[model samples]
Target: MRMTISTHDHVLIIDDHELVGTSLMLSLRSEGLRADWRGNAGGEEGILADVRRLDPGLVLLDLDLGRDRDGRMLDGVHLVAPLIDAGWRVLVLSGSSDRVRIGGALADGALAWVPKNAPLPALLRSVRAAAQGRPVMAPERRQQLIDTYHEQTTARSELRARLDKLTQREREVLAELAQGHRAQAVAERFVVSLATVRTQIRAILVKLEVSSQLEAVALYRRASGR
Candidate 1:
């Protein structure tokens, strides 16, 4: 049986599948918690409207918002940043097992990512913990996030050190190249001669220790976090 949710319901779920949403809603109700579900058709504006109307304490979100008319999966990552900015506590419940996707969601401020296949009791524990504003990452996932963070930090530091070797003019030239500007366009933009721009490009490659202009640009983007 379906439960009638009121504004006092503290939990709202956003999922693409009606069956899954209904089932989860029923399960949460059985635990004496009021909950409601929204389908993908609600869109971001609709979801925000619901949030405003419900004032839910916690939102369980799915990352995949279902397929488009062309059958491509609609990404829901874009919704995460705005939800975070709006002060919504989100817990991601998804079938996706991709570490990068899970990590990105958490990095984007999701409270937790509970694998859909996890035991119902475990999922309930995560929900309760999130509702209470507690840390919800499992041990293994926490370690994985830590390792990923360390790797990114190390890579960024190295890239910064390499970039530091470039002169101001060379850095400017590299920035232009990173934006897909050709040598001629960079020279024109900087009001420098083509030969001078080429010279700066070569120096940028040497200082960045990259073999080609594209590699230098890639390094610049990595260092700048672009």
Candidate 2:
């Protein structure tokens, strides 16, 4: 069964790639919804300009721009803040399957991240759901994301509680670990021996119950709710 979009809303698409954005624009308009296409939507100045002009009810943002071999310049990750700041409902439309990227987008305030190749019907359904002020993650992909999100968030909360048990030195070491600093760097920052930093890190990891520093930091960020 196909889900129908509410016909009265306006959706704005910002993609540097012409084919993908234009195709969606035409298809959506054919379904009796208002759609507009912008050549690109990144950078502070350009985004501000479009926000003023389009005043769209919803925005579909492609995460990639022309910066790599694949022509991806500004990351979609970078846009999340600005869009949220402008009070626009945004959906990330990207080809990237990196869960961290998707999670980061969600953590940064995007309503959902829909793959570029999702079925037109599903995309429209997501757009409509978002327009109606509902949070909509892709149904087929929701469970895995939900599980991972919960795990990361829970681990972070647990880490924060353990940090309360640590001394100020231990916390400084933990903060360094969360920032991806090496033991030697942490030692330098704290003016301690490298071995001391390593020991503190070991204690922190054990206390946090996380196997790796990356996971630890991910947990910490989730716990901070930032």
How big is the positional error of residue 100 in model 1, measured in Å on the Cα after superposition? Answer: 1.0
Clashing pairs in 2: 65-71, 65-72, 65-73, 66-71, 66-73, 67-72, 67-73, 156-219
TM-scores of the models, in the given order?
0.59, 0.57
Supply candidate 1's per-residue lDDT for 23. 90
lDDT scores in order: 0.79, 0.74
lDDT of 1 by residue, 13-129 (tens): 888889988898888888767788888765666667666766646788888888755566666666777777777788889997655566667777788788888998788888877
lDDT (Cα, tens digit) per residue for candidate 2, span 117-188: 989888878777888787687555655664566677677667578667767887777677777788888888
* Residue-level error in angstroms, candidate 2, position 169: 28
Please give the RMSD to the true structure for each candidate, in Å: 6.8, 6.9
**Most lDDT-accurate candidate:** 1
Instruction: Looking at model 2, report the run of 10 residues with the lowest lDDT sum.
Output: 65-74
- Count of backbone collisions within predicted model 1: 0
**Candidate 1 runs further than 4 Å off:** 1-9, 68-72, 146-226
